[model samples]
Structure formats: structure tokens, C-alpha cells
Target: MLREVTAIRYVTPLREGGSLPGVVEADDLGTYVVKFRGAGQGPKALVAEVISGELARRLGLPVPDMAVVQLDPVVARAEPDEEVQELIKASAGANLGMDFLPGALGYDPVAHPVEAGLASRVLAFDAFVENVDRSWRNPNLLIWHNALWLIDHGATLYFHHNWPRAEAVVHRPYKWDDHVLKPYATALATEGPALAARLTPSLIREAVDLVPDEWLDDGGKDAYISHLTARAAEPEAWLP
Candidate 1:
């Protein structure tokens, strides 16, 4: 389970992407980027974030610490923006909060070159999760303290958005042509298998277990575990 914290203050919205996740101060005196359950994509997006982010962290990838943020109505009542206030009202309870990186910059291929082995691992992980958002135009990565960090995994595990089609695409090949790291992932043959091997059944289950219960609707938790476990088992089909 993720460390739990209560939102002590609602800072301004980050407004980086469509989900409209905002920066918040929590009871632990830590700043966080909180993704609300009331966001357009709802809790499914939050679930994906937790599972993928935690899995990446477990695999020795750089990711911020995550916590379950308890949202109180008092914060909603103080919001000047009606839209933001409504969003808060809708997501009155538990939400996803990630430790804020104060001065992190968006990843740029030119300024921050990724190593071949690391790029291959990131590419392989994205393929395993069927993440379609890691394109050059909208790379969801950050550079913090000269280290590459994975972020915004709400766009990964897209299969859960349509359960019936998930099974159909279980063995689908990942299209790496548009992947931002594809050019740098020259060691896929060696690095891909090594990274994929780390995702044993227990590791996959551990990642899935991080998702909160309320976020899992219609046995979505089991579906996620099954889908990812299956993908992990057959890396040859998806590894680029």
C-alpha cells in the first residue's frame, strides 16, 4: 500500500496536460502533484499511474515517491476557481499524489542524451505496458539532478480503457517507430530480455497490488494483473 497523507493545502494547478493534475501541500509537509479522481479520465487513469510508476520504481527506474492523498472539503470551499472547486468537490476523498520535483525540467534529447542500455530498458518497459504516449512530441519524462525520471504514466496501460479489446491485443507488437527513445535503444536484443526477465509474476503482482481498491471497478484489478502478467510472459511479441 502507498503511504497515506492528507492534503493540507491546494496549490495552483500544474496544467501541463489534459488530466489537470495540480500541485498540493500535504500533511507530511511535502509538496506533491495530485491527480484527482474527478479528472476527465477518472480513477482508471490514477490506477494506471500507481501501477506503472511503482513498477518502474521497483525496476530501479527513477520515479517520485507516491502517496494516497486524502482530500478534504475545506480545500474545495476555498478555491477561487469554480471549475477547480467543482473538480475538488467531485474528488473529495482519496487521490493520487506524487512527490514534487521542484526544479525538474522536461526531457530533451539534445540537452540530455540517454544511454543506449537505459533507453532500451525504458522502451521495453513502455512496450510491455503498451504505453503510447512516449513520442518525441510529448515525451512524459523529466530530468532531475541530471537523472532521467519517468512520470505521467496515466497514459500507459491503455488497454484497461477498453477491456474487450485488451485480450485481442495481448500479444500485439509495440510500434516503436515513434518512440522518442527508439533511436537510442540500440541494445534491445540484450537489454530488452534482461529488463523483461526482471518482471517476474511476483513483481507484476506487487505492482498491481499498489492500486487502491475503490479505483478498481468491475474486477479491474484482476484484469490489470492478468493483462500485464501475460504481456510480461511473452516479451518476444512486444519487445522492439
Candidate 2:
């Protein structure tokens, strides 16, 4: 289970993507970028966030710490935006919270060149998870303390959205031409296999186990575990 915290205040809305996740202060005295369950993408987005982010962390990739934030809705009373207030009101229970990386800057491939090994690992991991959001136009990455950190994984594991065809897409090839880090992921041939070898069934389950029960109302836990385990078992078909 993830660390649980109650939202003490809604600091500000981060209007980056469609979900409109906000910066919030929690009872734990830590700031987080909270992804509301009521967002346009719904709870599945939060599910993806937890599974993908935690999996990336287990793979020795940099990802912000996550928590199950308990939202009261009343915390957003002072917000001037009606949309934000409604979002909070609708997501009055468990939501996803990521440790806010203060002072982090958006990643610019040219400005911050990544090493080939780390880049390869990230690309391979993204491919394995079928994350399509790390494009150059919208690199959902950050540079904090001069290190690359992955974020906004709500777009991953998209096969879950259509359960009937999940098996068909599980081994779908990853198109990396526009991947933000593709240029630097030169060692993918070697690094990709090395990373795939680490994604044992146990490790994948450990990542899926982090998701909260409420989010799995569809009883999709076993499905996620099986899907990822199957995908990991055949990295050659998907690795870019």
C-alpha cells in the first residue's frame, strides 16, 4: 500500500495537460501534484500513474514518490475557478498524489544531454509499458538537480482501456522516431535486453501491488499482472 495523506490545501492548478492536476499541500506537510479521480480520464488514469511510475522506480529509473491522497473537496472552496472546484467535489475521496519536484525544469534534449545507458533504459521501459506521451513535442520529463525524472505516465498501459484487444496490443511494437530521448538512446540494442531481463514477474507484481483497491473496482489487478508479465517475457517484439 502507498503512504496515505489528506489534502490540507489546494495551492494551484497545473494547467499543463487536459487532466489539470493541481499542486496541493497535504497533512503530511509535503507538497504533491494531485491527479483527481474525477478528471476527464477518470480513475484508470490514476491507475496507470501508480503502476507505471512505480514500475519505473523499481527499474532504477527516477520517478517522483507517489501517495494516495484523501481529498475532502471542501479544501478547494477558495479556488476561483469553478471547474477546479467541481473536480475537487467529484473527487472527494482517494486520488493520486505525486511528490512535487520544486525547482524542476522541463527537459530539453539539447540543453540537457542524457547518457546513452540511462536514455536506453528509459526508452526501453517506455516501450515495454506502451507509453506514448514522451514525444519531443510534449516530453513529459523533468530535470531536477541535473537528473532526468519521468512523469505523467497516465498515458501508459493503454491496452487496458480496451480489454478485449489487450492481448493483441500487448506485444505491439513501439514507434520511437519521435521519442524525446531517442536521439541519445544509442545503446538500446544491449541496454534494452538488460533492462527487460530485470522485469521478472515478481518485480512486475510488486509494482502492480502498489495500486489502491478502490482503483481496481473492475478487478483488473490480475489482468494488469498478466499483461505486463506477458509483455516483459517478449521484449524483442516491442523494443524499438
Best by lDDT: 2
lDDT of every predicted structure (CA atoms): 0.89, 0.93
**Residue 125 error for model 2, in Å?**
0.2
Model 1 Cα lDDT, one tens digit per residue, 1-240: 999999989988877778778889998999999999998988999999999999988888888999999999687566788778888888988999999999999989878889998998899999888788899889999999889988889988888888989888889998878888888989999999999899998998998998889888896678888888888888899998
Best by TM-score: 2
How high is the lDDT of residue 109 in model 2? 93
Each candidate structure's TM-score, on Cα atoms with residue i matched to residue i, is: 0.97, 0.98
Model 2: runs farther than 4 Å from truth?
A: none
Model 1: lowest-lDDT 10 consecutive positions: 73-82
